[model samples]
Target: MKAVLFDMDGVLVDSEEYWVALEEEEVLPEAVGEGVVDDEEITGMNYREIHGYLDDHYGEHLDIGREQFETYYEDAADDLYSERVELIEGFEKLADDLRDRGVRTAVVSSSPLDWIGIVVDRFEIGEHFDALVSGDEIEGPSKPEPEVYEIAAAEVGVDPADCVAVEDSENGVEAANRAGMTSVGYRTEINQGMDLSKADHVAEGPEELRGLLLELTS
Candidate 1:
């Protein structure tokens, strides 16, 4: 592979649990009342798009505006990144190894730019990436649509066919496949129940992910 593209939330940082908790326990309940939204419904979507999805499905019952609903996530992100988030084991070393081998590396995510910045800064891993692309940067729909990964491949100066994408969500795997890259589905305790069978490969944990990357780029 000429490049390696990574998804941020569950693949790079152990933040999926925090997001799931925020969505299930706080955001959904306050916006559309309890028992309406599920964690799976918004797992791989941009925070703003989560509000849009909820509005589309349950707008009639929603008493709050989208902007207001987003703050819950934004505030939670601040706390998560600063105090709670942890990097996936071996990710830093894997990123460094990829860069040493002259393979382009990047972070491609459904998250907003500022949120991506928080994670990168908190973990001090930004220098490992040749590019960082956020779903919010594109005008089109995010993951499960392939636009973000397509843009990411272009920005990193690699053909989609020559890149390998590591993802932890079904939507993320779908997006990478649609972009024509080799997709590696990552399974973690946080996403154990999600289907990732569409990916070209599957890695059960961080060490497995490292082994996959090493083999792919070797």
Candidate 2:
């Protein structure tokens, strides 16, 4: 592969639960009226898509507008990701290996820019990636829509077919698939319950991810 696109949460960093908690604790209670927009709704969606889910489920009860919901999520996200999020083991080494092979690397996440920035800064993995595309940077849509991965490929200047995407959730796998790239499933603590059967390859851990990538490119 000429390039690799990585999803942030549940793939590179262990921040998926952080977001789930943020929704359960902060955003949903205030916006969705105490127990609306459950974990299932939050699991596979990006922030914008999450907002739309809330609108569809609990919009009438919200004491705010769509922009207000966005702001609340944005603010909560800032607080949520500020804490030190742990990096997946061996990912640094794997990233270095990919770089050493002259492969371009980038992050294409459904997270907002600030959240991705915090994790990137915390882990100091910013230097490893050639590009970082947050869902917020792209207009109109999120994961499972293909646009996000397409944008990442464009930014990296690589053909979609030449890139492999690493994803943790079904929506992310679908996004990568729709973007015309092979996608490796990244299963982690946060998304252990998720079904990853649709992925091009299933990696149970960071070490497995490294092995899979090398094997695929070999």
Candidate 3:
């Protein structure tokens, strides 16, 4: 692989757990007014896109306007990414190894640039990446669509076929694969239940992810 694209939430940080928790506690019950939401249907979707999805799927049950629903997520994200979640174990070393090998790297996420910025700054991992592509910057649909991954490949000047994308959600894996990149499924304790069967490979933890990435990029 000439380049590696990483999904930020569950792949780079432990933020997904927090997101799921918050959604269960507030967004689902208070905003969308749903008692049960299948996260697989939403994870890897941009926060804005998520609003459209929820409003469409649960429109009849919605208790808030689009702006208010977004506020619910934005406020929670500020606390989650900045003050709560930690970078995944071994990511600094993994990123450095990829860069040292002349493999270009980028973070491809459904998050906005500002949210990504907080995690980058908090972990000081921004320098390890050549590009940071967020869904907000793309005009196309979010994950489960190939646009974001395609954009990431372009941003790093690599063809999609030559990039290995590591993602923690089903939507992310599908997006990478559809973009013509090799998709590697990453798993954490909180997202171990996710079905990443569509990926080219599955890495169970940070160490496995590091090893798989090194092997692929080698």
Model 1 over residues 23-139: C-alpha lDDT tens digits?
A: 778777888898976677677888878777877898887878877988888778888887898989988788888888899999999998888898889888889998999977889
TM-scores vs. true structure, each candidate: 0.94, 0.87, 0.96
Query: Over the stretch 1-218, how does candidate 3's per-residue lDDT look in tens digits?
Result: 99999899988888898888877878778776656567677889998888788778877777777797788788888889889998889878887788789999999999999999999998888899999999888897899899999999999999999999999999999999999999999988888789999999999998888888899988
Output the worst ten-in-a-row residue range by lDDT, candidate 2. Answer: 35-44
Q: lDDT by residue for model 2 over 131-203, one digit each (tens)?
A: 9998887786788779889999999999999999998888889889999999898887777777788888898
Instruction: State each model's CA lDDT, in order.
Output: 0.88, 0.81, 0.88
Q: Rank all candidate structures by their TM-score, best first, as comma-separated numbers.
A: 3, 1, 2
Our model 1 lands, by Cα RMSD against the true structure, at 1.5
lDDT for residue 152 in candidate 1, whole number 0-100: 93
lDDT of 3 at 202: 97
